[model samples]
Target: MKRLILVVYLLITLGCDKKYLEAKPDRNLLVPVHLEDFQAILDNTADMNNSTYLNFVGADDYLTTNSGYQSASYLMQNAYLWKADIYQNSQTGDPVGDWSSCYKQVFNANVVLDGIDKLGGTADAKLAGVKGTALFFRAMAYFNLAQLFCKAYTTQGAANDAGIPIRLTADVNPRPARGTLTDTYRQIISDLESSLVIIAGNSNFKSRPSKLAVRALLARVYLAMGNYEQALFYAEAVLAESNSLLDYNTINATLARPFPAALPNGNAEVLFYSAMPSLAFLTSQQNSIHPEIYNAYSENDLRKQVFFIDRGNGIINFKGHYTGNVLLFAGLAIDEIYLTKSECLERLGRGAEAIACLNQLLIKRMKTGTYVAQVSTGSNLQLILTERRKELLYRNLRWMDLKRLNLEEATALVLTRTVNGVSYKLVPNSGLWVLPIPDNELIAGAVEQNIR
Candidate 1:
């Protein structure tokens, strides 16, 4: 079934010029029809689990020298500078680009969902699991796309804000128009809430969606949306089931890849497994940690050694990825849940509880004996935010954090980059935070492009 799905995917996608919305599947080709076949479509991890890195490239966690900036592809160089236009009229067919990749995941999820409906019977555990998995994938893809392509969700302006096109079916002929930010997020939350009722508990294979994975994703989505109460609800739900954090002291920081391979990810911290698609600029040795971010970690913080490799002359390359390799892990993990929980607690005026919760994870991350429990004070919010930045670097959360935090005056940030003696800055709430739609999609004339 997997091979069959792959064949159909290749036949439809290879050398295709039509937008994802308009490209019709061949009627003559064998299509997935059975329950297992639909499951196979969801099981194709390469398509289902990999996501875009444009946000990562545009984020402030890393920096590169002028020569290194020149070495990057034109698209990435623009991203690094937070240019008004990053694509520069590039076509959409590139599978790793933000628009194409996320839409592809949405399409596949819709395929499985549409097929499941065609089965037309009372669903057994297997059938229900497949349905839940499809819903989770769709919601996850939508949440990720929203973070990059739409304005940050706020209670006030969401109704007026433009959002990515929301496609709910497998049919390709109908070009859906961009929906309201409220509608888009409502759909995401709806799908996740529905999946929560049907999916089983945590699966041994992290690649597959489980009950806890759904909760973890819900926690993350709510956090991004600034619904701190609901976010705390979901975060605590996940921690109730599984809240294991890897002790960095036990990991060998000297190895090229310190963590275990993600194929059989031994890292107990991971909840839902997904990775950012690889790009040359992100993996290049010339890329170094931003000084502000690098200096935040105290010398006794084991992450300083476990997460980075000093390449000499103060240039540091990140080696600590939960995916256990060069590919940045964008999936949910327990550590992130802790951060989310702590942040919510603090925002809700439970400062002492937030500090206690944060310390549970921080103790494991620091050297066993050198760790000091953080005290709850006026600085508790800033303290948790700092630790959040330090712990989740390169996991694809920083960009979203920047967007959400900037919604408030106190947490707003001004990001800057210097390339060839030229300085570029992206202010809080800049229109550039919302990326432009791919030119190919714009040329198709189905949806409106972002104003930036």
Candidate 2:
């Protein structure tokens, strides 16, 4: 029956050639009439596990070997090089899998938000939690969309910069225009702040978001917008609630695989759960770790052992995913909070304080006794930034980090790639930073294409 239901879901989703966002409702499937029905829609991991295929491909964390390069699909190959059109052929269908999935989640959330008020009794009593969770999910979906479709939020031009459309209602509206970057961010923050007040303190299940999850996500949003104060405040607020770390020392690093393959619901550090598909080409040995990043880890660093699989071919593949599944985790975790706080402190010139936070996180990640506390004098800011890169690889934060970090003159970087002996570069603040909307959406007249 579960298999039958999934087949029906896929059939309904795939049968339409109409715009993904404006597709007519499936008359055969049950409408989410009850609160639990809406909750079940949220639980549909197929639609909700936000995939970061493009972000993962676009980031500079991994280098594709010639073999891997040739074997990859055209979409994957183009994405790796920051091409103007990732989907070169119109026959490839819409290249908006992540975009469509995100908004689908938004639609589900909106359904819950729209319908909950019409019901009564116990479901109404539980409305606060339901509403908060729906809001959080919608905010998360929009945030992800903004990062891909909009330019990095800069104070000077955000009011003019185009952002992804804001879909706040569940009505079958066919067309929605893009909002300004400022408007997009305002909606995201408004939803998060609203969620914080209503969401309960913590969830027994990591998959269900809570107050801490909302705070952590807000910190990430502020950090991207270069709002160091709010970022710091939220990071600290979450830490105050809970700052548990997964001690790498306790993990078995000697096995063929190190981290647990199935991160249980009660995993100590994960604040929220979401994952990207571990597509074979991305995680396979042919796509090796960037040499510089792999070499940066010290021999005693437990992450070096637990997070990678060294094939002895002088290249390593990542294995230290928080989700014990093959899927790469893009969820909120305490380690990210610590790093955000540290970056915020350093950016605010609280050098000593920043190093203290870094030191606290490192103690758990390093070998039991060999870990030495790091001090942030002048050189330590680089250390903290590097640690952030190393810790958050493949989590879909690197692209945003690149955008934000490149804004600072000191840390400005131009990403480069070499494939088949041909080198390509993506300069800092290039228009290429904003990805084009999928072609099908443009053809359908439902969305405008991003300017390249």
Candidate 3:
């Protein structure tokens, strides 16, 4: 069954238009027939679990030298500058870029769902798990895509704003039109809520989705949508089930990679394991941590040493990926949940509770004895946000944070980047925050291109 699916997948990969709007798998191709076959489709982590790296390139977490900027790929270069068109003159049918990659996951999930629907019977626990997994993956893909391709969701604008194509079935011939942002988020939340009722508990493997992962993802989605009460509810749900933070003091900060691999034996705080596709600029020595962010960590904070490598001559590179390797980890973890809970609490005016939640994770990240717990002063919100920026660095999250934070007056940012001798700035609420759809997708006539 696995071999059969692989053959069909390769054939689809080679022959179809990779754009989600126009992907056209051959009608004669074989489809998965059994339950295990569907499970195998979802378990293909390389296709199902990898996430977009463009957000990281565009984020403010890191900067590159002039030489390094020139050395980056054309995609990375334009993304860094926040250009109106990032894929200028790039070929239409490239199968390896972020658009196709995310849609591939969407296609795979739809395939599993179609197969599960055909295998109608009194579903056993295994079948139930498989169905829930499919729903979770589909929701996750849409959420990630929405963050990058759609405008930041606001109650007033979501009803009219354009969103990515919502593909709900395996049949790729149908080019679904770009729906409203409201419908897109509605589908994501509905799928997750359905999965929450179906999935039982945490899976043994972090790569697979479970009830806990569903809750955590829900928390993340609500946080992005600016629904603080719902975000707090879901975050507290995840914390109540499992809230373990890795002790940074125990890590060997001298090693090139401080964290262990996130499989077999990896970080305990991880709820789901997914990573960004590797890119040379992210791992290059020339790609140094932003000075302002790097200097924000206190001397006693173990993360200062545990997460970065001072390559001498004022070059500081990030080595503390939760993936335990070069690939940047972008999946759910307990630390993020704690931060979300704290932020939501602070927004709800529960300042003391928010400070406690922030301290709970901070203590684990600091040196065992040198740490001092933070109090609920007037600045607890800023303090929590500062820690969030530090702890969740390079997790493919900073871009989303920037988008959501910019909506508020106090937290809005005006980002500036100087390349060569020229300067580029991205103002808050600029349409540039919503990236343009690929030219191929526009040419396919399925969706309207974003105005930037």
Candidate 4:
């Protein structure tokens, strides 16, 4: 009779009960997935794919790097280029796998969420907390797609421009059209806001979306939209919760040697962070910050010593510690929140506060007495941006920062190259700024390619 009941349910859903009964889910499948699994997946999102995101993140890293590779690598670097330029056949689909990956996360979260609603759980409050975290990851996954595949949250929207294909439900057939920027942001804000409520009451989210994490994400969204006031509001809230900094000063000694491949979370400074996807390409691409950037660091500046690996060849990749190991990213923390706050303050004419926030971060970066902020003569905006560059260099936020600050052109200015010793400008806001949608997906019937 139990088998009969299962057959009836499967038949109702798939019009085929035989397959379902034969598949036979194991006991692990029978149990409700909790915050653990959901958090585990969220803990692994990384910087520009390294290898994964690089396909979609575009070759800004390479094209823009003074010492990096040239057009051959840059041609297919990311999803930003016009399809005609590379694929030429319009078959490459940027939204395909991402659409699938994000939905996988969403599915995991939904199973957790619905299981709590139907099967019941160990604790009502705990279940609710798990639900909140799932919502945050789901939103984050979608937002990641939106920013890269969709147009900016601009005056004109999906009616005229492309937005990433939004996936609200779990169905796989008949993939949907790209959402408008407005609609995409609505989803992001909605998911985050709801998650905040659920996460606020529970304390078990050791590494998942804590109340602070939600706020940090919200601030990031606001910052992206150029909504400085709202950005400041949420950023300030997250900053208040952090008690530590990744202080650049002790980097060399803290972990010692080649570093641990990845920094652990809940550190004095790491509000929330994953070990992250290891960057083994260092052996090949030799990826690192430009030497000019390394030189810019003050002698007193500790971040350079801690975060950078200066090869003294006008190139300094991340130290052996980060890129060597680790296969994760995306947890949470106060670092980005502080940068968001600083930018918001500068935009709002709070120069002193902006500088103060930057100094707070910088001060912690250097020896207690070293590297003070001198009164700079340029726009406070530049100061905030420079701090952002120094602070978040290797974490996958730089390109977005360039976009948010409308500095893509400025970024482009510096991202030129001399292949065969022949100079070439990397084309600001180049079609290549976005990556080509991945090649494998175009064969699928449902996925839509980005404009290129």
Task: Give the TM-scores of the predictions, in the order they appear.
Answer: 0.95, 0.92, 0.95, 0.76
Residue 326 displacement in candidate 1 (angstroms) = 1.5
lDDT of 1 by residue, 66-144 (tens): 8889988888888889888787657644533777778888888887887787786227777778888999999999999
Ranking, lDDT, top scorer first: 3, 1, 2, 4
Greater-lDDT candidate between 1 and 4: 1
Clashing pairs in 1: none
Write out the backbone clash pairs for model 3.
none
RMSD of 2: 2.8
Give the alpha carbon lDDT tens digit for every residue of 251-357 in model 4. 55433233333343324434444333343342334455555566677777766667655555455555423332433233345667788888788779877788878
Quantify all predictions' global Cα lDDT against the true fold.
Answer: 0.86, 0.80, 0.86, 0.55
lDDT of model 3 at position 323: 90
Better of 2 and 3 by TM-score: 3
lDDT by residue (tens digit), candidate 3, 1-452: 65666655764564355444354445446656788878888888887889888888888998888898999888889999999988877445454377878888888888778878778722777777888998999999999899889989899999999988998987766778999999999999999998898875868788898899999999999999999999999999999989988888889999999998886447798899999987787788998899999999999899999999988877899999989888999999999999999999999999999999999999998888887888898557788899999999989999999999999999999988889989999999898888888877776657898899
RMSD of 3: 2.3
User: RMSD per prediction, one decimal?
Assistant: 2.1, 2.8, 2.3, 6.3
Model 3 TM-score relative to the real fold: 0.95
Better of 1 and 4 by TM-score: 1
Model 4 poorest ten-residue lDDT run:
11-20
